[model samples]
Target: MFLNHSREVLRLLTSLQADLLILEENELLFFNYFFSFLSSVLGLSITIWIWMLNKKQNRRKDRIYKQLSGTNALLIIWVILMIISRFGSILPIVLFGTPGYDNHLNLYEEYWILFVLIPIVVFMQSWFTVRLVYQAGRWIFSTFLLCMLTAFVLQLTTTVSQEKLNLAYHQRFERDYNYIDQEIRIAKEKYGIDYSEQTVEILKKQVTESSVKQVESVKKAFFGDRPVTLDTIILQKIIIRNYKEGGRYYYKRNAIENWRYALPIDILKQLSYFDQNAKETKELLEVLKEMIDLVNTPEIHWQEYQNFTETERRRSLGARYNIPDPLIEQLKKVQTRLLEDDLYSDFFKNLQAIKDRE
Candidate 1:
């Protein structure tokens, strides 16, 4: 019977492990639901077993009854002290804004003394006396507490482990994002193009305001006494706006439409269109090559956008901008030619294989 019970317990525990294995990263909602249900079932089972064990012991009527002795009082005192010590340790953690269950194992470590004394308390108590019901109740409550605490500890471990992995992933993402930003800046500098969010906002204000003085004030606040030509301002506005909207149009296919609004494409087109003279065409080609490099970058994963269907690309954030179809077609042709000659041919092909579900 003991062997069968042990096997049953082991099976339940194994099932719980399997449930935990299926839980994905940062998914606390489902994790809590499963953990709570399993622990409750386990706790109730143990509580029932303990009640049955106490009932069997109740059959022994020869068991002596005694008054609350010094040893009992001393044991109770020790238990109280153990609880106080545990709470004392936890208070600082709570005050510092850490959740009580964040480090569930710490509860065990802090109150190990209390757990050691529980069995002793059970053995010393008189099972035949009126205290039998109270003792059973305490046992049931303790069993439930241990079961839930174990579940909480396991949940914490899984969550913390996933958080660490995500931290590393985000760190790598930021590094790649910064690298792309730097490349975009260099390309803009090469073409004598200057653009930023502040600049765009400033230009918008200037366009809306009727007062020339207010516009000059805004320009001075941004540029700080530097002379800026109206042509330069218009070009900067175009470059900044196109880079952002165009990037969303050409790339960011895998991302949600609303979220893709935050992502701006590289300033490749702005540099290409800055000076279309024959003398600058060679330099323009270099800028185009840089754009191609940005697109093919394995780290940025821009292929996801390239793999997007014509409908998806056309339905981008900049779809309303109505970028010239001729210019768009020419850029695509140049990009295709560049990819054919590039060493990362395999990478580009892999991108093509990533068909958009949309």
Candidate 2:
């Protein structure tokens, strides 16, 4: 049990280390941009389709499907399609996307309903109302209840909550924004940048600054215009340093960092999107493939290489041919330094940048 705990701790630390080295500011900025870019066009298309798709009458094909009256042929297929559509959104998002906070938008994909289940839903409801068909109501209601029970049970283990199976679902609701209002409590905390309309409006109107006595420390470490502190490896700053240290060989680091934050290229820059049809969407997928490539590349283990070459003093850098590599000793240092360079430290540092930008 102790060993299992130790292993989990080691894994989490390793992941944190990896995330620190690789997650770049630009890529995050880019991702936001890409998300926006895709959203605008996709949203417009969805709106248009929804507007056009809406009809007072049941769709012809949906009517056909509803007309078939058999437990085997009708109920089976309708149920199968419903199950597929439910999983298409609820299953995948609940299963994988939730924990990572990935692609919640997929949980809202139009095809899940636009082409299939929604029309079926409309058909079933309409057929019963128009023709007063109440014969299959027993089976339909039973099947629906059974499916809901099954879904609720399965969701317990899914990435999405077995209980709260909604994407736009707020964990809790607050009607008032007042920090001390009777109805509103700040609670312990909230999420990443509150870009909700009200918050964005406020941010758009103000800038906050902190005048630090040891401002020079931050400047040296992460800011440019002077030498970088060991921790402050900015892209433009690093590009200049890369040329000085090992030349273009280190350029890949820039690419990797940039790619990580790039999110989506045109989106990152917030470029013009004159084209967003099927072809453009296809091209976007290809760009995503390239981004995945960059995400997979491992961080360079310069220390490992140095440790390997300790026997050959001439080949190694950093404090001569290097001292004996002690795993226990280095791990202790990692734990100690983690206290110094904690998550809040970096999170606030970039947070300041976002504030500055506003």
Candidate 3:
């Protein structure tokens, strides 16, 4: 029965080690799993040897005492090491909040309980096995009760940790989506573009997808397989510094610009349905693309005037940059077609207003 139980434990441990090895890309987890497995195997071997010594009849008490003395000495040294490991694992999280520079230590903290549990379980099993030789029923009941209690504690801890993790994930998702929605709202106010139902749906879908990807990226940085690279490390430091200095608004502004650029392209493409001349439409699309790029450039800033109209500001900036006459003529053609469509006339009008402000 003892041998069968040992075989089962070995099998389970082997399976777990194999599963962990498959995640070897995560070097920190790999090493933690390796060391924990090594310690468990060592502990189990020592227990088996002690059990064998107990079974010997010749010089039984003396032999058992000598063997147990050595085991106790080893256990004391292991306990000291475990304490140090546990302390090292927790100190970084208390200081940094998350896995920052000392990811190895953080990973150890994640599994340190497992490391502590393995040796303890082994020692308890050894004690119970020896006791069973004399008080079989009592030792058996005690071992079963201890196992149940240990399992219950472990399950409770896991459940609470999982609930906390889920809550955090949802909060992050909501926060990111809110940021994206704010940019969209600003765009709507500036452009006066009464988005059609279809267009609104498209924008929502795209924004949701983008937000999910962004959140996933953050999750990966926190808890995924981290590869060490100089560029990545530098980027992480920059991001952390930015957050500390309240420069996170920079990301919000960047998102605003990205959506600002994307919205016009999509709206313009949809409005192309109003123009039937395929050739002119193609040319108009090309010119619109060029105009969007030109207007977005830093050099295209509108000069303030006491009573400058939107068209006047555009022409002045165009001349200042020495924009070609042909490009200007093509843009005027686009403006005329856009204004002819009652549904999107306000879109082009507000678009010009944005250019004037820029």
In terms of TM-score, how similar is model 1 to the real structure?
0.25
Question: Per-residue lDDT tens digits of candidate 3, residues 59-93?
Answer: 66756754664465456447645764554434423
Candidate 2 off by > 4 Å: 1-67, 70-143, 153-225, 233-358
Error of 2 at 260 (Å): 12
Candidate with maximal lDDT: 3
CA RMSD per model (angstroms): 17.4, 22.0, 17.3
RMSD of 2: 22.0
User: For residues 1-358, could you state the per-residue lDDT of candidate 1 as single tens digits?
Assistant: 2222332233233222121111243333443434343433333443333443433334344122222222343344455446544644444334212211122333244654654444334433323233533445665456546655665664444332334433443342343334445544654766555666554333322112222233334223323323333334333332222222221234343323322111112223333333434323334344444333323223213457666532234234233232343334444664564457543244345433211111
lDDT of 2 by residue, 111-182 (tens): 334333433453343334223323556655654454445434432332211122111121111111121122
Candidate 3 TM-score, true structure as reference: 0.30
TM-score of 2: 0.21
Model 2 has an lDDT value of: 0.28
| TM-scores for candidates 1 onward, in order | 0.25, 0.21, 0.30
Q: Give the winner by TM-score: 1 or 3.
A: 3
Candidates 1 and 3: which is better by lDDT? Answer: 3
Q: Model 1, residue 225: displacement in angstroms?
A: 28
